[model samples]
Structure formats: structure tokens, C-alpha cells
Target: MNELGLNFLDLGDSDKLPIILIHGMALDQTMWTPQIPVLKEHYRVLTYDIRGHGLSEVGDAQYTYKMFADDLKSLMDYLEMDQAVLCGLSMGRAIVLRAYDMYPHRIKAMILSDARSEADSNETKYWRENSIESIKKDGLENFADELVGNIFCQFQFQEASGSGGVNSKHRLIIFIRGISQPLSSSQMMHDKIVNSEFKIIPKAGHMSNLENLEEFNHNLLEFLGKIEF
Candidate 1:
């Protein structure tokens, strides 16, 4: 654990450039279980639980993407890493983008899976408010099904924000999306990052990396191989 009390695992050669994996909301670093062993063979890997999730300490302050990005930067500082490739899944994508926006020099590249680049709509805001109210009223476990249903079944995830500062020319970005999920957002991101590569994982849903580990890992490794790093 670092000074922020975040539970993290740093694996592979310390001499190699690192690849940091950021999991989605409601998920811990363990979600990257399948990819860890494979990735560790080539580069240093870092996986950590976001604040308030898994074993990470949750402070009294309200959580925001900016804060999460700060935590990521702080973790890098603690590890004495000057730069690393960032791989984010779902809500993790937002955190990655925010981090790049704030500290572009620290990010060597980006791998965004199941990403979204749009601002949240009013309906999304309403649903988020309703979900919070429901969770508070009935507790997390009781509202789990409903929350998951809305996010997965209905495909109503909170959209991303603060992407205007990300410039495509300076970095190599890879976009990975599930074949079953909506592709518009991924396409938008791909278009935004002209030099970025995009891949679709077959027979996968929102959680593409977990649902189709083989294909996901293949794409990841391919990207890693292509990069100069």
C-alpha cells in the first residue's frame, strides 16, 4: 500500500516501463486477474483499488474523477515512476482521461476499454440520483440487482466528461470495445484520437476483458508490441 492507503500490487521487472491497470466502478484491481500474468512477462504492471473500493481507505471527502486522478499520480510518485501506460475499464476510462488532462506528461500512452467520451445526459443524471436514493434507502446488497440491471441490462452507464484537453498527436492510444456493447462512443473516441488503434472483442459485453480474456489479452499484447516502448 502507498501513502494514500490504496491496496496495490506492483509486479514484473522494476527496470521496465510500467503499465497501470485501473478497474471500473464497483470493481477492484482483482478484475485484471487474467491479464496480470500475461502482461507481467513483458512490462512492469501496477494494479490498485480505487478509493472507497476493495481494501482502499475511503476518506470523508466526496469522490470525484479529479481526486481519483490525483490518487493515481500520487501512486506513481510513491513508486518513483516518471511515466507509465494507463489502461482503464468502464469508469476507469474517465479517470484515465482526467489524469491525462491534468498530467499529460506522466502518461506514456493509454488503453481505454469499454470507454465513453460524452457528457452525462439529463436522464443519466436522474438515474444516478435515483440509484443513490434507492441504495441509501434499501442498502447496497438489496439494490444490487436493480443497479446492475440498469447499468448493464439497460446499458445506462454514466457518460464520461473532461476530454477536451486530450491531444491525440502526442500519445499512442488504443481503444478496445465489446462487440455486444454500443460502438458509437468508441468510434467517437477513435475519431478524436486520430493515431489511436481500435479493436472489438468478440462475444463480449460491457466487461469485455473478463468476458473474453483471450481476445482482449491478444489485442493488449499486440498494442504493447507495436508501441516503441
Candidate 2:
């Protein structure tokens, strides 16, 4: 409980059922900034830094998405939450799916943004392995700079605005900074968790929520509304 507590950020009313927001790899709760204010108006929102990222202390490098799901379950137990909505992006999405598989009873609904459930493409896996080797040899900073260009749509970077008129440069900057921070080897463990249940968000690159906020929000809100709370 204490270990999990150190990783989460509790926002909005504690009296309400929690809505946990799990961010993608490298990024932290701050990535969910746009959704917080609006979501808090209707539900208690909980966001967290995955272990080894953000304010959370790094855990074992030999971890899987199921382990992350366990962390969420542990956090919910510590907070005394019975069930909550799980919203995730990219790596976060994998965690949510694993959580659903592990403790479906604890999840009221799920929202996966800018993510897929299938394992990384062989090409992507090769790149990830190469990048990890490079990072180990060089540093996270250099690796992050090289990675940013693939994170957002070219139009978003060029227009300086994301879908639905959301500013992307600011988001991109924040994301880059987060990724540039120290990260543990646990990130490589994600490669072991072959995702196969993911659905792609249209017109989104990697940062789907920021890339297509309007559509993402509408789909998210609609899913929330349809669920029997």
C-alpha cells in the first residue's frame, strides 16, 4: 500500500468512485492536464506516475503490464476504492487492459487512447532494443530528442495546434521534458507484454489524446456516460 501510494496522485473528491488516469511511458500525470479539470467536475480523478517514471521511485526492471495492474489494484485497495473507470494512453493503455484481465470487477469501464494491444511490430521491437542499447551507452537526453519527432503528427507540430485546436507544442515540450528525465530499465520489460486487444484512435499518431482531443474526449465522455455507475 505504501509503495503504491508513493506513485499515485489523487485529485477531486475522495468520496466519489475514482477515475484512474494512467499516462504513457516516460510521461506522468501531468500529461492528463487537459482532462483533469473537466473530469473533476463529474468524478473523482486519480492519476499516477508509473514506477520508474516521474515522482515515483523505480521498481524492479523485470516487470510486466500485469505487475503495473497489480500496482493499480494495490493503490485502489489502499484508497478504499471499490471500482473505478480506467483511462490510459499507450503504455498506460496496456496497463489498463492488463488490469481488466486481472480484476475486471474493480473496473467500471475502460478508455484506451492512442494505443494498441498488439505486441510491438518487429521493426518497432528492433528499434526499441536498439534505442535501449543506445540509451544505456549514451543517455536518456539524447535518446529523447531523437524520439520526439515520432510522437506527434507532423500537422500538429507544424500547425502548433493539435486536433480540436488544442495547442500541441506546449504538450510536446512537456512530454519531451518528462521523457528526458531519468528512467529505469523497467521500460524495456514492456516489450514482454504482447498487447492484442488495442483499438486505434483515428487520425492520431502516438499521442492520440493530445493529437485528437475533441474526438478522444467525445468518445471518452460517451463511454463514461454509458457505463452504469
Candidate 3:
């Protein structure tokens, strides 16, 4: 735990350049276990459970990306880190964007996988609301079909009240997303955040990281291997 009391797994040599990995919504650090072996050898990799998920304590108030980003900033400050490679997947991507928005200089690079630059889509919002209503009316077991299909980790980049949003593309960005999923919004995201190598993992869906760990790890290492420390 650092400043926010977020349960975290901090590994590798302290002197190494830091690489912070943020997991998707409803996911814990364990989702990143597969990538740790390689990352530990070259970088100080940090993985932490976000609030209300995994082993982290749940906050009393409503959750927001700003709050999540602040927690991350606090942890980094406590660790005395000036900059780090920030990697976020799905919902984690939104948190990453929030942190970058608040402290751009703190982020050295980014690894965004299967994420959008906006909030839940209409279809997603409908199903999400239905799930909530079903749970409230029938309890956890009422709907036993076990919601099929992939629940993607997504995001939307918001801006200040009068400010235009993040328009320019980011440098050192690596975008990896699954090809099986609907990617209508991907072009929009890429257009705004220009060229960063985009790799589509074959035979994978929204949960590309877990679906094809071997391929994901390979691509990730290739990217990290080339980056200047």
C-alpha cells in the first residue's frame, strides 16, 4: 500500500524505471500476473487494485475518474516517482487519461489496450442499467443466463468546462485491441491520438489480454525492449 491504501504488488529493482499497470473495472492485479515475469526483469512494475475492486477498500462516496486518478497520483508521490510508463486496460484506460490530464509530465509513455476515448455506449448503458434493475428486483440469482458477450474496458476523455479536449496524438503510445470486437469507435480514438503502433490480437475478443496472453506478452515486450529508459 502507498498513499491511498490501495493494495498493490510492487516488484523488481527499485532503481529501475517504473512501469505502472492499471487493471480494468471489476478486475484486480492478478489479471496482470502473466506479464509480471518479463516486466520484473527490466522494470520496476507496479500493479494495484483500484478502489471498490479486488482487495482495495471501498470508498463511501460515488466513484469518479478524478478520484481514481488522485489516488494514483498520491501513490506515485509517496513512492517518490517523478515519471513512469503508465499502462491501462479498459476502464483502467479512463483512469490513465484522467491522471495524464492532471499531471501530463508524470507520464513517460502509455499502453492502452481495448479502450475507447469515451463513456459507455448506448447498448452498453442499456445492459448495465438492466443488470442493476434485475439485481435490485430479483437478487443476484434471478437472472441466471450469465450475461454473455464481452464487457469491454472502455473510456472517454473529458475536458474542462470551457476547454477543448485532448486533440493531439500522444507520443510513445501502443494501442492493442482485439479484432473480434466491434471497433467502430476505434478510428475516432486513433484519429485524435495519432499513430502509435496498433496491433490486433487474433482469435481474441474484448478480453484480449486474457484471451491471448502469449501474443499480448510478446507484443508488449517488443515495445518495451525498444523504448529508451
lDDT leader: 1
Give a tens-digit lDDT track for model 1, residues 109-221.
Answer: 99999988898789977976786788789887877776455345222243215567777688889999988789998888788767888899877778888777889999999
Q: Candidate 1 — number of clashing residue pairs?
A: 0
TM-score of each: 0.90, 0.75, 0.82
State the C-alpha lDDT per candidate. Answer: 0.86, 0.64, 0.75
Clashes of 2: 4
Question: Candidate 1 at 22: error in angstroms?
Answer: 0.5
Q: List residue ranges in candidate 2 displaced over 4 A.
A: 161-203
lDDT score at residue 42, model 1, on the 0-100 scale: 90
C-alpha positional error of residue 62 in candidate 2 after TM-score superposition, expressed in Å: 1.1
Evaluate model 3: give its lDDT. 0.75
lDDT of 2 by residue, 1-229 (tens): 3555456668887776578889987678888887777778778999888876778877656667777888888888988899888887777867876777677777776665554434667997798679868888988888778777768766567667011211222111011111222222222222332321223345556676776666556656655665555
After superposition, candidate 3 runs with Cα above 4 Å error: 1-3, 129-170
Worst 10 residues of 1 by lDDT: 151-160
Residue 179 C-alpha lDDT in model 2? 26
- List RMSD in Å for every model shown: 4.2, 10.8, 6.7
Model 1: residues >4 Å from true position, as ranges? 146-161
> Poorest 10 consecutive residues of model 3 by lDDT?
155-164
